[model samples]
Target: MEKMGYQKNWNLDKIFLGGSKSNQFLDYIKRLEVLGRDLERCVKSYTTSLATNEAANLRKLVEYIGEIRVNLSQANSFITCLHSQNTKDQDAATLRGKVAQIESNFEKKLSKVKIILANTKQDVWESLIETKELEDYRFVLNEWRENTDKHFSDEEKNLISDLMADGYHAWGHFYNALVSSINVNVQVDGKEKNLSVGQAINLRSHPNEEVRKESHNALESIGEEKEELFAKILNHIAGFRLQVYKKSGVKSVLEAPLKDNRMKEETLNAMWSVISKYKKPFSNYLNRKAEMMGDSSMKAYNFWAPVTNSNQKIEYDEAAILITEHFSQFGTELEGFVKQAFHEAWIEAEDRANKSAVPFCAAFPLTGESRVFMTFGGTFLNVLTLVHELGHAFHNYAMKSVNGVNKRYPMSVAETASTFSEMIIFDAAMQKAKSKEDKLIILDEKLKCSVMNFMNIHSRFLFEQRFYEERKEGIVSSARLTQLMRDAIHEAYDESLEQPSTYSWVWTPHYYITQSPFYNFPYTFGYFFALGIFAKAKEKGNEFEKDYLNLLRDSGSMTVEDLVMKHLGEDITSEEFWEKGMEICVKDAEEFLKLTSLDDIE
Candidate 1:
């Protein structure tokens, strides 16, 4: 039996088999959906009726809806997990689709409620919140009120929502397919290797310089061939986004992401400002690395190449123990969850055909259970992968105690706990480094990752900004988009790279993502955010843990600033708050310098 606490193999049958096919399950679902619809209607009717402050009625409606929503989402959690685990599973896929359609139908019906609520007097909303029975939903009601200004006429809002299925979303799918299907021919040891997009990218991290450069060339070559289509997709998506942003009265498309991030412009500016200062240190790190590799200058392709040496391959069991021991510092709850995750086969770690390429965790919210997906082939990165996914699992654990209504954290904060976990475990690993070469290898890994979050992610953010700005003018040509992307990259990495080694072509896939523009900033944000928060924990000692957990607990309930203030007493909108994180970045450079002694290595 696997020793991890949670089982890796999920019981999809719990959701859809046995009693699932029976009338009881079907009846329960139908009745729940009906109740949901009814509750929504009640809220709308009461609000629109203007019948003598029906605060009690509103409370009853919210409570009923909350109960039904929890049950419905419990069922949804199972279906979602099964669908992801086996997208080809016909029955599961059908169930998932049906659930989604029902949910959308519910959303459409609820739009009426939103419109009604929007028309409600501010005094009425305040009275409802002050009512004993309705107080539970105060947060939800307050948030809705905040969004009232963004609410368009029901007709336009509904039309836009429905239109996305055919328009903007389709562009995103096309872009993904184009990138995923791109074939690259890489030369290795005098042999030509045909690679998928992912394989080619992974090869950029190869120890062999020739392999990395060849892979980079192959990737860029394939991207060049598809540039026109990629540009068209980017332009169409951006145009669609701009139209919607204008319609919604958002100043820019970035406003939504930033608002959604619960952060302000100053926070981002401060983070990048600090990152900008470290460009010199990064340049030094790269230079030192190049000298160690006996190269005059390093190309973009050689960025992920291994430095110095790594330890002997660790067994999965050994890695689990190491991670468990490291995570124990957080508390027994986190440790036990990590242990359960490994023991119960909650992790699909085996390398198998027809499996996902990246590591991720999916939570079964109903049971507060989670499954981790990854292909672990015993590399150190594989261990880190486990740690990262387990970080997500830990987040799920923290959220489990929250109402399902308040557990869905935004994507920007979604990475916070996971990245925080990575730092904790990595620090432990770094401390145990046994030799100078091992220390170099460890520091190199840290520095490379830091560079990616700061420099690479910054480049993507800049390109996306330009893409959105220009895309408003209509479709950008492939060549024009490429040039804009190059300019964005050069601007972000101004002093980070030495002459003649820049690879501006890397913005290809990132710019092509459809659903979220500026998908890149979240990474850098998560990194610096966690670091800043981590620094607070170090200063305040054990007392900070409660505040931190409370902040996490409120992630679903409050604005990002509110959460930060509750936990770390810092305003996310302030430049100083972000610069604190940046200062840590500088300290990181100093540590790298102190530990590695680049002079000797060079």
Candidate 2:
């Protein structure tokens, strides 16, 4: 694999002919538009009750909506893939706007269908879902009906959907553009150089303390410069959401995110309760890390600071081999998928100018394929990212045979497979460590994961929660937002930092997105969820491999609680279950302490 020099750019031609300008792509767009219109016509033509026609029209509507959804996903994925590689590509941006319009139009039509379903008699709707054609989509239909029950009139829903294209969602795009256009000047080798916000943020973990501080100050300066504009962006986005919630008669803002996560409020509270008890261990680990780095106390920038001095670099091909070897010990199926993802042109792993800063894996339901995006910098963390994304790709592969509608899992469970894959690589490296330093490096990575999921994400969740609570009263000023974020950080982590981060709310993009309200907690939920499953796998040994795949395959078809109960035989809403997960983090921290002490002799 090293000799082959694996393909680093994705083959977009597999999605379309000429990457957005092709005749084939244009024809496909027209077809999607026609399908939307036809579906609308079919729904409008059904005036009688569902029982009058044996749900024939309802079945047709479900199939048509599914087809439209799959095609739209393919189009959106391709345009995003193109835009991520070249942020300045106007053609890709224009196509994305057009796709957004198409999606909004489809949503309008679907809203009408939902209104019709909501108006149907309960007995009739229940019987209609029992039909052979609609059997697989039972959960989907029920969810639509439930949401419609809480919504306003069809006219208002359609208006909201139409306005969101240029109203709510446009603000998110505006924020993205604002941050992307920012370039910070930093001194490198005694020379001033310009770096993108994404590039500068990555420097927080740089080996040099001065460089990390410089990078952190540069990023905070951007927030200071544009504080008012940033405040307006957040205020309006949250304000618009509040207006919709009020009109829909939603009493609590957390209702939608909790529903989106397929979880109950009890589960979230229980997990956080368990999480709070384990923070001391992680704080201790951070203090030890600070001492290892010759510092008395850890600051915000020092959270991701490296513990070991090893500078070993692994090539892209070598990283692939390492991942394959480690995964082979678990199962042959996963090993094969990882190899195929690299051997084929399914990943864009090269580091270049103007590319997106984030790493993600996008799955195309229409083609039953997925594409992963990342810049491979040859670090151990980068290797972990590769395996993490491969875990996502494997999840998509596991559900290829299932229906597209059923394949949509919540954000909470979405990270289960990815984090599980990271654990595999983490343990493999720990076992292969030949020296104390090597083992320390591996332990550092594990402890860093614990700190991130336990502390950093907890602060984010608190910030969002408070931001929403205040946004409902009135627009929050930039200073007020800063204070709120600082308070949240203080509550989550009791570390006395040299310089506290007050601009976290401004640079973090999670607050700007309207589609998912509380995106922060799902990460913490996913880490713990995967940790619990991994613990079970360890206890069951190789015999659990088949059940593991089965669990992944069913992730999309059922609720998280149901999936856990059936596969792991544990109640996720219980405090005991969450405690079991948090114990893993505590155990890892204790192990790190033992490894660092001279009394330990293996």
Candidate 3:
């Protein structure tokens, strides 16, 4: 990548003091926090004095609330960014406490406001957006309105929100504890090595079949022993959410997630319907993967096995160049962002002490700066990950202009820009392939990924849906949950797997991820959606690039369907929309097979 002059003069401490003494900064923050409380208190206090449609008072309240909110959030952004980038930094940690204090105090003040809104005239509150300048707050306002209907009382809502710090959220931490503590004893280099779920599952992608099998079996055995506890947790969390959903007048537990996604339930169902019809194509890809791995009886554990020989290494500098070259095709703006990311020292590139295991991107809008956290070890996957995360930085860069409201897109669209960036890098790589062998490896890896994203992920989602449904009636027994899982795997994999049962226990984590219920489908949706969008680009040729970037830019402002319709001239709800995307993947799978020829050898 070309140097964009970010490294010449940059210091993190200039923005944040980085020590406990940053408490001095808290005076300004605390003042703002108190101002926020005053604003909330004022709004709630005057709730009885004015009618919902009282344009003047309502406008004043909304504007004041918006101002307090922006100040509180800006302070929040600074503190959160520092803590996330360097958790051990004392200033950041101190600021985190300050931010928590602000939220706690603000919540107490806001509780009355919430109650007032809940008990108010519904139509009048809904119409407040038009009367006020807070049009960007429609989603949050709607959510607040929904909360009012389900609210027990101001005291009750406060208690529930407080207890949730230790109740629902605590359950999530407990689940994480269980996952972290699980020690699967797998045979590595003829020695028994104890591994965590993250480590063990990764072995399924190992080049060695023996390592993969042992890792898979050991991983399953560990989860099998704890299945009952896992089932209970799943049961408890599902029951909790269903109760909340019912009280809120929401028809389905999925209602909240759908709302959170900012799309209709019908759209999600439509996307999956298209996905289900294309399962055969996914199965065919899996079968090809099995043949490539020389497995007569493939199971879920074998799903991530390397189907092509591409242990290719890349230098960090070269990786940056590839990223810039690929992204530059989109336009100069993205190229500039990519260059800035690499040169500005926005990325923590090499694995080092005090760094976390996973990769993430954090943006600081106060300075139009973004920090990428990843340890680049020069592997192809690492390079791809760099591109993936840089994609996130690029996203926040585009979104910086939309402050406060309308800036936060739903989780569904959050992946759009990143996935779109991945497609760009992959397509560029494919185009520049110097040999058929290289091309085959790239093609096979890409399709193998597509199959896993679409099929394997869908199976996990299928199981979660069943588990939640069953849990609604009562607690699902470990044995019952296991059986349900096997059924889901059977349905999703169908005839693709020679033995799907062996890997049934692999999805235990999904059953227990309390913080993110039904986390499986979003990944599959993101992957295929990007494929659909990329396919459109192919059809439009040169005219597609501007529209693609424009769609990404507007992801924060619009619904998923609106973005799709605006760019692709198609609605995601239609079967044809998904079929087109799946067909493209099928064609890629065919190319992967023809080039690999491992099926012929088999």
Find the candidate with the highest lDDT and give its number: 2
Q: What TM-score would every model get versus the actual structure?
A: 0.86, 0.95, 0.82
Whole-structure CA lDDT of model 2: 0.82
What tens-digit string does per-residue lDDT give for candidate 3 at 496-536? Answer: 77545433543445545554566666666677678877777
User: Backbone clash tally for model 2?
Assistant: 0
Task: Tell me the spans in candidate 1 whose CA falls farther than 4 Å from its real position.
Answer: 1-44, 49-52, 63-97, 134-136, 149-151, 173-196, 309-315, 498-516, 539-547, 594-602
lDDT of 3: 0.66
lDDT of 1 by residue, 1-602 (tens): 24543333445454445422434446656776786677656655553523336777765655565556566676665654554454344565455445655655666655665556667777766666687765656777666556654447767766776666556665764554445445567887689877656556656566577888788777677667766666666677778888888877787767877766656777677767767766777677776677667776656677777775332566777777788888777666677888777666667665443332335787776666777776555556667778878888878878877765567566677777877887877677778989776776767767776777877788778777876777777777778767766676566666445432223433345554555567677778777668866777667755666666766777777666666777777877766777676666666666767766634652
Off by over 4 Å in 2: 52-57, 131-133, 149-151, 189-191, 496-498, 540-545, 598-602
RMSD of candidate 2 to the true fold? 2.3
By TM-score rank, best first, the candidates go 2, 1, 3
What is the per-residue lDDT of model 2 for residues 1-602, given as tens digits with 9 covering 90 to 100?
A: 34667888888888787875767878888888888788777777776345635566677677778778888988888887887777777788788788899999888887777777777899888778887877777887887777774457667777888789978998987887777677888876577878877677766666667777888988898889899999999999999999998887888889989988888899899888988877888888877777777778788787666676655777888888898889887777888888788887889888666777667898887887889998886777788888888889998888777765667788888888999999999888988999877888888899888887888788899998988888889999999999988988887875644466789888888889778898889888889888888888788877777888889878766778888899989898899998888877898899888877662321
Query: Which is the leading candidate under TM-score?
Result: 2
Q: Give the TM-score of candidate 2.
A: 0.95
lDDT scores in order: 0.66, 0.82, 0.66
Q: What is the lDDT of residue 103 in candidate 2?
A: 94
Clashes of each: 16, 0, 0
